[model samples]
Target: MTFYFHFLSRMTLALISVGLLEACNPKSDTPQQPSGKEKTTKTEMLESGAAILQSDSPLQPMNIYLDGFHAAKDNPAHQMEAHHFCRQVNEDFAQCVLFDGNTRQANLIGIEYIISETLFETLPEEEKQYWHPHNYEILSGQLIAPGIPGIAEKELMKDKMNSYGKTWHVWNSAPFGKTGDKIPLGEAVLEWSFNQDGEALPGLVEKRDQRLGVSTNEKRNDRAELKDLAKPQSGVDALKGKFSMPAHPLPGVVDKKAAGPK
Candidate 1:
């Protein structure tokens, strides 16, 4: 009887101790939440980048209904309801080259999308079979992340200062050994540059930049005419001046293009 009483007392004390401990430090089964300071810090970091990405007119104007520029306009009401939604999302899609200017672990926020079909028709069989848009992978800074001066990774070093510049990082989408067989939705590579007025540098980003496959030797569809001019007149004389170039899908790529408001 004494042993049983002693054991019961000990168990009661243990329970009481546990209750005190829980009272002192409440246990939460839920995931740990960021403190106010931590959340603010994160929000600031994300906002800083999103602001840069949404700083002004996008470097490349989207042809779609809700390209980067039109994001705000598309859902003003929703944006008002959600202060950081569009901004954060836009920045997220744009990709971050470096965290706080660090070059390591480039965070992917956006991509240079091109469909595989376009490349299929444009690229030769050898280049075509291997480079599928879906298989094309992109590095964070290659497209939207700011560019670095002096060191050109994929293409020309024209504005090559070693400072941050923006260019789309183009890649062969093919996974390690597998080649893609379908027409990829995001296929094209683009170079993004901003003008002094904060407008997208159309000539630079769309036509001149090499990262988007625009070089002196390589020209986009519109400039294909210029390519003809560069070629010797022998081929020119045999060919009509007309040349058909691939059309870039407008920027807003959400399905049901006609479904939304105009």
Candidate 2:
């Protein structure tokens, strides 16, 4: 218990320091141009007043921020950068609000609910199809907490090992290098993880890295120690052989069910 509290203290301090430094230069990756009439001065004033008077208790708990990429389950070609503002509900469960960008003008795109492997095992087989495995996301360093210190980020990833996430993207308002729908359109689509290298769209991850001043390769190298914590996860092979290029398996990521008998 002492060690736990000590670690928490260090994490808190690191977050505070990093937050202060990053405030000077905030980064927002996606550029969204949702079709909407410009807000009038009167409307802006009302919003400013509401911000001061309203108690956003529900949103207050959403403290953790993460950036990752997601591809449409049925179509690997459709991919986008996902910014997650998550609230940890418990030791084994979390819920996140997804956005296309990380700034005030960003569009709300979807939601994702995450659960530990233990909690996931309790779900029905039919329901399991909706959840995607997270091992590859973490091990490959495709998921990141942008403004946090390296130690804090690693600890955060360590806690999420072997977890599963069920994500539903409701808006097609912003996609990589293209003018998306003027407004949200069509049915909500299920998003999946990139299980292998060469699966993500070319130049997709690069643009995000350039904008955020982070490196996926560096992150992947730093997280090498966490690989030992990995277990064969479900959905790791769901998009196998789907990419145009020959996909290569990420080290330490495996899908036992997909592998069959040894």
Backbone clashes for every candidate come to: 30, 0
For residues 1-262, write the lDDT of model 2, one tens digit per residue.
2233235445545656767635633578457687779999999999889889997768766757789999999987889999998777777888899998887788899999999999999999999999999988998888988776688688888888899999999997677666787678899999999989999888998988888889999999999999999988888988898877778988889996966775
Measured on C-alpha atoms, candidate 2 has an lDDT of 0.84
TM-scores for all predictions? 0.17, 0.90
What are the runs in model 2 whose C-alpha is more than 4 Å off?
1-21, 259-262
* Candidate that scores best on TM-score: 2
lDDT per prediction? 0.23, 0.84
Q: Assess candidate 2 and give its TM-score to the true structure.
A: 0.90
Q: Report the Cα lDDT for residue 245, model 1.
A: 25
Which stretch of 10 consecutive residues in model 2 shows the poorest summed lDDT? 1-10
Alpha-carbon lDDT of model 1: 0.23
Query: What TM-score would you give candidate 1 relative to the actual structure?
Result: 0.17
Tens digit of per-residue lDDT, candidate 1, span 122-240: 54545422221210011111122112111222222111111121223222222112342222235333322211111221232332133223232232222222222121111111111
